[model samples]
Target: MSFNFYKWLQEQDDIIKKGVLFICDSLFVDCNFKGYYIEDNNLIGNVLAPQYETLKQYKELNPYTNTEHIRYFFELTKAGIKHVATVLSYERSKDTMQVCLEEQYEYITIENGVVEMTNFEPLTVLIKEKFKL
Candidate 1:
């Protein structure tokens, strides 16, 4: 199964989709994903992206949220990227990984916040070009 952004996104719950949008928005604002992935499931004091300084504050701001749940989705996205790179024989590096995520986010933006593919070329083509596949 190849990576299909819209299909993968449709499988997520609403909260997780919102979390991903938050991540994309953060990246768009500052081009930084410094602490998006959480290894220990500890987001309370951890700086997750630039906008939300801490998960505690994020929760306070957005009451109907589970930080851990959102973190899980974040990890899933990261793992999916790693899997794509491996399957496509692309060298896994920080820069390349960031590019993959950025391109996907840009695709979402181009779709007017929808997870459809309309304005851009097939995602595989863009990613293949990056990987030289």
Candidate 2:
């Protein structure tokens, strides 16, 4: 039987997806911070909002102030970039990687003596074969 690597990887636990996004974002940030030109800084965040939301909620519930930001920080380190590259290699070798878009929005309203409106475009997964990394 021919194995479908992309499907298999997608079926892996949510950690895999989260880890991938985190690493991607970290790498982008590191590159930009080092004065490298980046086309879109929000690309990773937009694609991975769902996963990020999950991780954020998890941290929020746990509520440890100092450690709480660790996840965010992790997504922007050299180690994070290396990890992302590794995962992408695995994903590409299997030929089951694609870029997806997730449309996200925030409401503008007045609350707690402040008015705010924000919009987010998150990254997502699509059913396809291979991505240029």
Candidate 3:
């Protein structure tokens, strides 16, 4: 997570940099909120949430300048942000690393139907039950 966070920092736009920095700090250092709890302690939770005031502040801002993780990057700064909060699996095979938001009210689910045509990776989803806050 540290490596990925550092990589993202160097590549992100200057405007979004602060939001990205805050998220990185919260995730890698000061985690003050609980988003969710999962099996084996794997947590996928909220990292940032947009405020009505911030919405006005960002309304005049330009769109993200890059495409990598583009959808999430913008969502994090101007709207609601969610992420993989923690992974406590020991065997390395006990992590699900995902949460479906199809019925969740806090999220706006986008189904482009593009990835539906891809093949399966024979991966393991070990969580017996997923909990959201």
Candidate 4:
């Protein structure tokens, strides 16, 4: 079955919507994405990581202007952020990278949506460090 991002997004709770947007904005700025678009039921984009020679060089040249994107993700769970989000890349298909939140006061359920495009090495590092992944 084909996925419908807009339909799925509208069905989600407010916090999940916010988190998805947060991730998109973070990737656009941090990873130097050309732009975002929906394709085959997935949000798709390309990152500029391949243009750089080395991860260190990428890190040196691009310092995070704002830590709130990364910071807010870490606080999502604590602050009662609910739902599940998966951050994936073309290169790391085997790795299931997730930042989980909550749903229902009695118990929490994690849901998956979105697909990370390209190999955002530097941005991945920042997210890993922030989320302690």
lDDT of the candidates, in the order given: 0.30, 0.26, 0.24, 0.30
Error of 2 at 30 (Å): 12
Q: Write the per-residue lDDT of candidate 1 for residues 19-87, one digit (tens) a residue.
A: 444534433321122322322233357553334434444445555432222222222232134312110
Task: In candidate 1, list every pair of residues with a backbone clash.
Answer: none
- Name the regions of candidate 3 deviating beyond 4 angstroms: 1-61, 70-113, 117-127, 131-133
Ranking by TM-score: 1, 4, 2, 3
Report the lDDT tens digits of candidate 3 across residue range 40-85: 1222455343221222233234232211121111111112433322
The alpha-carbon deviation from the true structure for residue 61 of candidate 4, after best TM-score superposition, in angstroms, is: 36
Expressed as tens digits, the lDDT of each residue in 1-133 for candidate 4 is 1123223333432444344456535634222222211112121366331233332332354443211111012222212322222321211222333332222111122325433332223333444444454
For each candidate in turn, the TM-score is: 0.24, 0.18, 0.17, 0.21
Each prediction's total of clashing residue pairs, residues at least 3 apart in sequence or on different chains, is: 0, 7, 0, 1
Best prediction by TM-score: 1
Pairs that collide in candidate 4 are 82-102
How do the residues 37-117 of candidate 2 rate in per-residue lDDT, one tens digit apiece?
111222344333113333334334434322201111122234243211111213223322222211221222222322111
| Model 1 spans > 4 angstroms off | 1-42, 45-63, 66-114, 119-122
Candidates 2 and 3 compared: the better one by TM-score is 2
Error of 2 at 98 (Å): 19
Distance (Å) between predicted and true CA of 45, model 4? 12
Off by over 4 Å in 2: 1-3, 19-86, 89-133
Judge candidate 2 at residue 48 and give its lDDT.
Answer: 37
TM-score (C-alpha, index-matched) for candidate 2: 0.18
